[model samples]
Target: MLIKMNNIHKSFGTNSVLKGVNIEIQDGEVHALMGENGAGKSTLMNILTGLHKRNDGTILIDGKETYFKDPKEAEKYGITFIHQELNIWPEMTVLENLFIGKEITSSFGILNTRKMKALAREQFDKLSVNIPLDQEAGRCSVGQQQMIEIAKALMTDAKVIIMDEPTAALTEREIQKLFLVIDSLKKQGVSIVYISHRMEEIFEICDRITVMRDGITVDTKNIPETNFDDVVKKMVGRALTDRFPARNPNPRETVLKVRNLTQKGVFHDVNFSVKSGEIVGVSGLMGAGRTEIMRTLFGMDSIDSGDIFINGEKRTIKNPHEAIKLGIGFITEDRKDEGLILDFSLRQNIALPSLKSFSPKGYMNRKDEQDFVDMLIKRLTIKTQSSETNAKDLSGGNQQKVVIAKWIGISPKVLILDEPTRGVDVGAKREIYQLMNELTDRGVAIIMVSSELPEILGMSDRILVVHEGTISGELPKNEATQEKIMTLATGGQ
Candidate 1:
């Protein structure tokens, strides 16, 4: 075995995130860790990478017991991790970013720039990544940045690598290239721990699979013997009767409309509308400008040209505050960075967006805020001991609830969710879907942008496929399918 984790137990304050989890990986094998959003897969990986201290566990590398005090220590033991969020300096060139910590030094302690660039180019070529070594890392596309992160890990010459949702933002072509790299790594005898929610990738690259649920190991099986449905059933615990709820037969009058929306290079000449109590989904490949449309609609990005209409009345939105004032709410894709204030308590995070609503004569009403937060927590079934808990400490699913609660508190007429369940687990995803249903039933118009095809098809009343910068095609709920969406999204007209 390349790595063995025995009876691991970890907790944060009163919340036990992991409970006696055991897993083992062999050399030259791609071991996939499957779970719903807050199922402790990340926690286990964090422990292995020395990002978090385990309460109790014995980790063995190559038959010897090991304990990592920090990520550097883990790297010394031939272990490296590539997180979902690429950690690279935008200002630095690829070469500089790759050799950040281990810079080559000359005789007098000066940096050896030439040698580092040469080494970086060699590593990039070896991994089949075509990114320019001298270019700034941040200037590269999201897919290229992801590849740079992997190349940096390779520079460490680690024996075992852990990748967390590495393909989340990648295009189909980029994913294929990544698979080729993984294949090469396997042939080189590198043990890979692949963590992803995309079931297709698991069956494509993984040799063995381990499912985690609420911090415990659920099951482990060979990929050839198991299938996506079986794996999802194991991860979610219950067989999903229907992936998406039935769409309402009648959508009410148009509640929101965007005419000739243009944000310059971001997105151009975008047009759409949402009826009251209707769920409209925007589907496209990453960087196809789906997110830009959402941002522009929510007033986060400046629209060079376009007009927004609420209840058939044209209105100008100067910023997010104005958008909110006009009864529009937006939930960002990156919850950690844009959605929540990590240091704030759950109650504070929920109330931050709508603070004015709970204020009388410019004085904040603590009791009213507490009562509202309490109600939302209970209604959302948020798994937290107290609202006093820091937002950063909560799991991904709970953090998402907090974001939802913030917007739902305002009682907006139109809600826009950008990848709302990006990292959430199966159970949490079901809850979110149910929440959407409840919201729409109450006459709230929902505009969602999602990368998951099933989510776009299942929950949407209408689907708009965007390619390049414009809508390639639009389909009603019954006519929408994976093939149709892909066809339109890939410029199939």
Candidate 2:
């Protein structure tokens, strides 16, 4: 084994997140760490990468017991981690970000700019990545930034690499490129710990699979010995009868329409309509303008040209406030930045968007707000100790539910959900799907943008594939397939 972790135990306050988890990864093998959203996958990775201290465990690196004091120490021992969230400095150039701490220096200790650029270029070429070496990392697309992060790990000559949801934002083509890189790494005898919720990806690339549920290790099996259904059953401890709720039989009349929508460099000439009681899915690769289109619709972005029709009447939406007042709600993809107020209690966050409903005169009504939040909490089945619990203290899945509850409390006519189930567990995903169905049944039109093809295929009444800032193709639910959507999303003619 390249690395062996035995009896790993960790806890946070009263929560036991990891309990005696044991896993072994071999060199040159892609080992997948499978689990639900809060099932200790991230906790185990954090422990291995030295981000958190394990209460009790034996971590053996290269057949010897070893402890990592910090991430730097783990890096020095040929281990690197690519976090689920982008960790690059947006203001710095790609090359600078890649070699941020481990800079090349001359004998006199001066910065070796020439050598660094050349080395970065070499790494980019070797990995088949096309990101500009000198371009600011912030300006790059999410997919490009992900590739840069992978290249940074390569630059460190890491023998063991841990990737957490690496393909979450990548396009089909980008994912293929990433697979090629992984193939190369495996050939060179690097141990890979792949953590992803996408079952297809785990089956396609992993040599071995390990499943975790509720902070415990359930089983580890060779990829060929287990299938997707087995893994899913282990992760959630129950067979999923239906991944998506039944589609609406009677979709209401068109409630929102976008005609000739244009956002210059972002998206151009986009046209779509949403009918009440319908879920319209927008599917695309990273940087394909899916989120941008949603942002434009939500008034979070300024449109260069377009006419929005509400209830068969044309109107202008200048900002989010205008959109909200027009009965539109948005659940952002970046929940941390756009969805929740971490410092606020769950009740406060849920009541924020709908404060007007609870306000008495010019003053806020705390009692009314609390009542409204209490209703939402019960409706959404949010797993929290109390309404006073800080939004930041909730798990990834619960935090996401809070975000949905916040928007659902507003009771908008149109709802836009960007990656509604991005980091959520399978069980939570099912709950969200059910919630969407319930909303549609109540005559709410939903526009959903998701990178997961399974979700798009399962939930969408109509699927629109975006490519290069344009709607490449549109398919009805019956005709939409993974292969077909991917073809159009890659600019296939």
Candidate 3:
């Protein structure tokens, strides 16, 4: 199938999201939709898939004007969208989720469980996913859940598939497997609209690229004809210097220390320490207990046995409130679920952690709260029309900025960042890195749990590799290499 979008315009309450974006997807090719956060890439896809109506545009499929009434209609027309957010039903079984609306039924309207299972199994096998169909979807790890979404889309037998940040939660091995599947799909004459912030993956897998900036199409080029520098320049409309900001560490006393931290069956004796102004990077394969360890430290989960020390004083933290009171902050990995309340305004979310300060007299001072929120929005460069804007209205990168701004308001001594740059664009990622540098300069100790090896190597003063819920190896910034980190992460001696 060949897809074409011309002069597409989209808006929400006078906010112009897409202002004349144009792109064409060829049959049997992997086309990349590249842009900075809030650049209208996802909105364009939403228009094409019938999630949102384009105010002014023309979409052609097979050289004929086509507009799907809804996403289901698009799916039925052999177009499938695997969104950036995994749409797994937590309470439903994996099998049920795979065939939620499109279930198999018998002649008498009875459910055909046997055939559904067989089809689901076949799709999972094609993706090399090992998840059990009967298991609760919520119990699976983020990476496993991502695989389930991929399998669900594949089962649609889609001629055109739109994948947005599909490999964000996947491990190296899983990424390789996904690439293999993409190659196989290409051979079968399927078209893939790949959307990702990871430039490496785009250059490796995509055939052609279309970049957008400020809701307008900037340029489109073949993968062989373009370079990383060129694409980033077009997306941000500026030249980006270094990928990571310089971190000149001046370590003070240890601000946070963990000794023999255990979360029962979840993680084993995990021990690490972070000095003031130090970035202690926690690197490992997905589901290797990195985020679990951080969650326990931030009092999100109960610790079966562990010793936590803040500024040389041992403390018992039973919940997030207690952790916050003790000068600790956590930016969770699952931003949609844990980081921000989608319905809340930006001011409300940013002022949540600092409510005590804003309400010292049992009443919030509106001016003070607004000023604080404004300062953070400007500092983080969060692109929003106003502080009263709903958190869900902003793009993914802006939502992440809001999450960071919420924690930064509390002025915590130790901050735990889980996948700080997970789905963020390159420019926003650099800004975040620069902010990390500024925070450390203020003597804030950071424990960053990241699955991206390059990020760990780029920003860390010290790196700790976790293998099987244990600290397999620790290396200083100078001595760390990608191969060494991967080796230790895989339980190497």
The best candidate by TM-score is: 3
lDDT of the candidates, in the order given: 0.85, 0.87, 0.92
Better of 2 and 3 by TM-score: 3
lDDT of 1 by residue, 294-367 (tens): 87878888888989999999998888999999999999877766799999999999988789988868998999
Cα distance off (Å), candidate 3, residue 33:
0.6
Q: Which candidate number has the best lDDT? A: 3
lDDT of 3: 0.92
**Candidate 1: residue pairs that collide:** 36-425, 37-424, 37-425
Sliding window of 10 residues with minimal summed lDDT for model 3: 263-272
Clashing pairs in 3: none
What tens-digit string does per-residue lDDT give for candidate 3 at 446-480? Answer: 98988788899999999999998999999999999
lDDT tens digits, residues 177-204, model 2? Answer: 7888898899999989999877788889
Q: Which residue ranges in model 2 land beyond 4 Å of their true spot? A: 126-128, 374-383
Q: What's the ranking of the predictions by TM-score, best on top?
A: 3, 2, 1
The candidate, 2 or 3, that scores higher on lDDT is: 3
- Weakest 10 consecutive residues of candidate 2 by summed lDDT: 241-250
